[model samples]
Target: MPTSHCAYDTRLLVITLILLRGARAYTWSFKEAPSQCGQSTVAVAGNDGTPPFHILIAPFGPSPLPNGIETRQILDIPFTGNQSEVQFQLTYPTGSQFIAVVSDASGFASGGTGVATMVTNSTDNSCFDATSTVQFDFVFNIFPTVAQVVQCQNLRISTPNFLGIIPGGQSFVIPEGTITTDASTGTGFSYQANLRAGTTFLLMGGDVRGNGTGGSVTYIVALGNNDGSCLSNNSPSSTPGSPAGATSSSSSPSSTSGSSAGGSVPTET
Candidate 1:
């Protein structure tokens, strides 16, 4: 019954951020594939202060698996347009391999404009100045043993750090097409966000696990201008004065992170 829980909701542990040079991306995720999958090429335009840009995510069918371990997949696809940052590691798995769909080809998305793909699968990609929308699909491959894929998502990568999605303190390298995990190599996930201005706006997150279940999601926002830097200018004005922001001031942990396994991520609301 809750809209979103602010504490320990694993589905909200990872965040994927995308920023474009002239537009904003309209991001949407799916757990059980869209009502229509890999069928439509129609792209809807998104607004990001700059001009309006439309884009389409080409469909990439269900993944091919290896074990009967109930395949589990986690994708960190990115979409972009104007200068917008999407919080990924804060909403999905860590070390998770993501497919880069950067292209300038005439696709349905981008309103006939063009998309360029750029993903070295690098770290704290600040120069992610490249504009393109990435569609990452994950297949949960943990069957015969468990049904739940993720325990949490969106863990606040406020500071790009080293680490990937960790379940029960375990880590896994997430990529686009394949869902994989290493019980021995503990997963590592860490992130740092400049917010350009840090917390000045509302940020929401969600986690998708291997079992084909949409984990859970939560949203947080900056309340006030805590510093005097143009970096802190990105925050929305309506936020509370007590929230966190200002490129000059570092953010203190104010929220909780969690995930779901046996059942849905406990509503953090």
Candidate 2:
């Protein structure tokens, strides 16, 4: 087997070959992002007798990856470890192509964790950006709460590679707080606060397709225009403690004279 350094050099040559030899068009590979399980893992493969690229993250150990994809814009690897605390060790070689996003978030994490893969060129003799290497020392935790006069806190949102918020229309606005970019989701990010009860918010919550997480529900939300309403699942609403009942925080209703028992607003799916 070629030494790990040899593998890195080879991948660099492959990137250059694709650029110079014009192998098809745009270069493509996996888009690494942070996860909820404190780590991310994927098995990257090469064609023919080529030795595949193996990426294992911290927090959760991963296995040799399996490869199968229909497109190049996205690369899907079999990941069986913690999704949070995703970071690459780059055991292959030094002169490889990869990007790492850090600086502020580079050194942060409380509940889960965050990892970002920026675009890195391999022209230099470095596996990662000369400025940033793959790191996984952060532990971020985000909690959705229901408190009156809630203290403003930064919510760590490890935006997914393909998940996104609805554009052109008013993005979701909660009444009590404000939203801003805690960090780049990739294309960018947004924050939300000052939210009122029942305020409909929007976000690209990871991809619906190839989402390996089970018991977790996925949906395509619809938004309305001025005086518009957010679209949601038509499934029957769930009461608290209902079987696998709803657990996401939601805005409450307008002030109306009613018994406190009626105050408990069940979250409709």
Candidate 3:
């Protein structure tokens, strides 16, 4: 009887510890980004009740332990049956590996603390021409809130390889008469950019904090314009030569009334 009681107590202790730890278990993996020049696809799986999470990609290091400079938040991943995948199609300038960290909505509230994985890379500097102009759009669907001023902030753009934030002012803007609203399901905001080809870039869109929620979400996608074809997943070897002086850009939203919430945009200190 004593032995059985001891064993039961141990089991209870273990269960209690696990419960105390909270429900946090996730597995993240990557595959080649759809475009040859773009970054890779990140697939994340949560142990039930992990949906509605936030995944951040940043340069690997200690300074950015939970969240720091060079961090791009891929916001509001929907609850697709305990698993969801997001694809990044940004070109890395020369050498850059992306580190990913995920936090459920609850975890994000207390600061970005959750599961993290090894660095992943999809480097391809020669995606286009350095001198040429490539027009693309940044579309984001951030979580919703009831606050009157539901907005997103800290819209930053950066070069691949985690070099540093682009210095020039925003070369684009959100349309004057566009529909940027806040809905529980999600809200969409669009911005246009005229980036130099062959250069890789990332846009870090943040969620508005004052409005309601925590952590923001954004995605980097290549617009299929007639200027050049959006390259599918292929090896750089397949292409001939690379572009020279490939750079990237970062732009903050002109206004605060955009999407979900907002926070301080991470920049090289």
Candidate 4:
């Protein structure tokens, strides 16, 4: 019978390709909503002999929760324009609430044109010059029992004594979003960078050029580790050399008289 009708049409085309591959199997789940999740590591710095700049990160969710996620994009760390310094990592779940808007506005990603400067903190030109984009609207809980905050001040030196010659010790605040322990606290030249939980450490400082004069400056702070390295206090550092532009040699005196600001500027890679 014609070879049994060509073996029943190859067994009905292998049962219609196994039912179309089980109807294009697809499954995804990320449940744990009670409120309070944490993770935010956004660092952007570029604008020195520019020619390459591109770092865009978008993660939005202002209202609508409970399930139907809206405005989702938890990753987009792109920078090939030459790259000065860029870091991006965001993960906030448990009733989520995010607004991480970092931008280069498409200057150079192997394309053309570039200009940036938005290091927000860690004083060193205090960057905000030739801006592009920078937004961080954070609110994380991460399931109760999560308190890792470091807020140390005294960065007010328009130029004088260069802040007592910069020398703070034991400032280890390493925990850039990933939970860990080994805490430390304030001391010496204004130190206060503690970490108990983890995932939030990027307190880089700068202002290099210490030859002496009114511009004799030197401020350094460090505490950023995820494998890149930079504990800074107990030993283990990197990223500390690129403040440039200091050739005054003589002309010091312009202090509102505010000292105590040292230790914690480690992210120069």
Specify the highest-lDDT model's number: 3
TM-score of 1: 0.21
The total number of steric clashes, by the backbone 3 Å criterion, in model 3 comes to 10
lDDT comparing candidate 2 with the true structure: 0.21
Better of 2 and 4 by TM-score: 4
The TM-score of predicted model 3 comes to 0.29
What residue pairs clash in candidate 3, if any at all?
A: 33-40, 75-217, 157-249, 157-250, 207-216, 207-261, 207-262, 208-261, 208-262, 209-262
Report the poorest 10 consecutive residues by lDDT, candidate 1: 244-253
- The per-prediction CA RMSD against the true structure, in angstroms, equals 18.7, 20.5, 21.4, 25.5
lDDT of 4 by residue, 1-269 (tens): 01112222322221010101112121111111111222222223323224333332222222123333332233335446655444333332222222122234432111110111111111122212222222212211111111222223222112111111111111122223323322231111323332221222222222232211111111233223423222334331221342211111111112211111112111111
Candidate 3 achieves a global lDDT of 0.28
Alpha carbon lDDT of residue 258, candidate 4?
A: 18
Task: Determine which window of 10 residues in candidate 2 has minimal summed lDDT.
Answer: 244-253
Model 2: residues with Cα > 4 Å off, grouped in runs: 1-72, 80-117, 124-224, 231-269
Sorting all predicted structures by TM-score, with the top scorer first, yields: 3, 1, 4, 2
lDDT per model, in order? 0.22, 0.21, 0.28, 0.22
Q: List ranges where model 1 is wrong by over 4 Å.
A: 1-39, 43-186, 196-220, 224-269
